[model samples]
Target: MSGSFSLFIVGWGIIMIVLLAIGGFFMFRKFLKRLPKEDGKSILDWEEHYLELTRHMWGEDEKQFLEELVSPVPELFRDIARQKIASKIGEVALNKKQKQITRDTIIEGYIIATPKRDHKFLIKTLKEKNIDLRPYQSLFEQA
Candidate 1:
């Protein structure tokens, strides 16, 4: 009877261990599936690489164009623009506008078109209304 009881105890221990192992295996797989996969390249990284290639192909004009468009905005605004570009919102409008605005003209236009510092006032008004301008930075940058 003693030997039989010991055999039953050992068998139960073995069964519990197997069940635990199976549960752990499934849990590990589920965890892995739920985790986000990384291709390693981020949107910014891709954009930089693409811009570098464009600069190479199109020469200084393309680089200057990108610099003029991208350099005016604050870093935070630039990041928002990047995300908006990824979303493809009003892409055609921006493409059309880019052709019209020369780099020299943009600086001059901003100075001439906005008087009484109205642009600052408008920004303040928008902020007061809780409007998020970050998303719209790309639209302005293209102008």
Candidate 2:
């Protein structure tokens, strides 16, 4: 009876260890999934939801709109738009070496396409998609 009881203890220890290992493995996998890729570029999880709204908003003109939306006034406001966008990009970026210059620059320039009073429309649209307009405000006087 003593030997059989000792064996049962050993078996229970093995079972507990296996259970802990399985739990640890799943936890580790979950952690790894949140980790960025080796290239330091990762698809943000919120992008899909944001993009869905943009798709609905832009419809067939998504690419064209994003393209022509920037500096739409051409030769007249081109330099003003460029300078304002660069200024806004500087504000949003933490440091000079920041890689986030392009996006906010474009958003700022897009704002230039609209009248100051109508800027709220674009801001509201972006806000609905969970996009923050604070970082993208350049053409406004207070930005």
Candidate 3:
């Protein structure tokens, strides 16, 4: 009877361990989904490679466009803009063209949603995202 009881206890322990492992596996998967991933290449990986290049190419004074457009309320505008970018980036950030489209959409939304813009941060972020502004000169000028 005692041997049977011990076996039952071990069996229960094994089941509990298996259940815990399964739960942990699912939780880890959920956590991983929140981070950027591109077939093992992540946004972080891209930024790590490009940050230096961008810093060397763009100057602090290059924010003239965003400064004028988002000058009124910077914090709020940035938060909203980042949210927009975050949402779109997940779908389109795998390639340069798609990433550019995501950046453009986020900036366009920023222009529309900004109560008052913070050109400094806006331009900084645009540079961070490597946005190409050649086609949007008119939009920038309007701000």
Candidate 4:
């Protein structure tokens, strides 16, 4: 009876260990799956690509739009200004007059326009300000 009881206890312990090991393996696999897949690209590279893509798609007007949306405090305004300028240049239209007007309106809208409730207002304001938007330019350009 003592021998049988010891064998039973040993078998139960082994079973428990096996079950725990299986559970741990599954948990580890799940954790790996939750982690972001690395394409061997550095974060800075990804950021540059994202910025370039955004610049290609939205241009300067979008930068100004982001500034208005964020309303950086005085300390951060210079960085915002640089971004605004860069984005503007990135999206400048072919017609100089139209581009200037669009730039001016974006600035004016940021300063004077009421807090917009919808994103469409930004696009509408750009159009109303007579800015020509070429959204597809980035897609067509060869990287």
Candidate 5:
């Protein structure tokens, strides 16, 4: 009976060690992914730069609109999704050297940043808002 109990404890210890190793591996991988690239910019740095570039252009109304646009995302992920979409929109605005954030910029940025699977939600939302999508049809097709 003592030997059986000892074996059970050893087995449990082995399992716990394996689980910890797996967890540690994933944590290390995430750390690597956040490291700066050749451009000397990490993902977080790029996001911050984009946000700063377009900060002056975001009015309360535009903020509200962006929140509404990302409402379809699950509650837990909505904030991250919103940030990514906003960053992308800012990048788009910067690329176009726009003086202000236009509706087209918002839409284009949202479409570009989101995965193809989420395009269906975007299309439905745009339709509900009566926003014409002819301009982005090709982009949607490519996605």
Candidate 6:
């Protein structure tokens, strides 16, 4: 009976440890998500910077198109992902001194902003939507 009780206690302890580990994992992810960038800019600051840089160039139609392009992102991260993509796009447009955002501009920005690990998903999404990969082959190779 004593041996059985000890085993039960051990099992409970292991379960508790696993539960704590799972909780910690989620907490750590939340903490990382809110962590400031190396340059001391908050996520909101970056978002605003991109928006300010590109606002004048974005028409209603282009804004709507961007939203549609980002629709595949999971709901929880969609806004942040959209902001990051837009930031890249804005940066590219600013560098080129482009007067407006074109489809190619959006595609190039999307490729540059997305991580290499996610390029497969990006390619799949683009293909499903009938976007050609030929124009952006170099971007994928570089990534």
The best candidate in terms of TM-score: 5
Model 4 RMSD in angstroms: 15.4
Model 5 Cα shift for residue 38 (angstroms): 2.2
Poorest 10 consecutive residues by lDDT, candidate 2: 42-51
Displacement of the residue 27 alpha carbon in candidate 1, Å: 0.7
Residues 23-140 of candidate 2 have per-residue lDDT tens digits of 9997786576557777663333222323332332333443343444443436755554434433333443333344433555446545654567766666765565576766655456
lDDT of prediction 3: 0.51
User: In model 2, how large is the Cα lDDT of residue 23?
Assistant: 90
Please report the TM-score between candidate 1 and the true structure. 0.27
lDDT of each: 0.47, 0.52, 0.51, 0.48, 0.88, 0.86
Candidate rank order under TM-score: 5, 6, 2, 3, 1, 4
Poorest 10 consecutive residues of model 3 by lDDT? 85-94
How does model 2 fare in lDDT?
A: 0.52
- Show model 1 residue runs off by greater than 4 Å: 39-143
Worst 10 residues of 6 by lDDT: 42-51
- Tens-digit lDDT string for candidate 6 (15-79): 99999999999788767756789988766576678779898998787788778778999998898
**Per-model TM values vs. the true structure:** 0.27, 0.30, 0.28, 0.27, 0.75, 0.71
What ranges in model 4 sit over 4 Å off?
39-143
Q: How many clashing residue pairs appear in each of the predictions shown?
A: 0, 0, 8, 2, 0, 0
Q: Is candidate 2 or candidate 6 better by lDDT?
A: 6
Better TM-score candidate (2, 5):
5
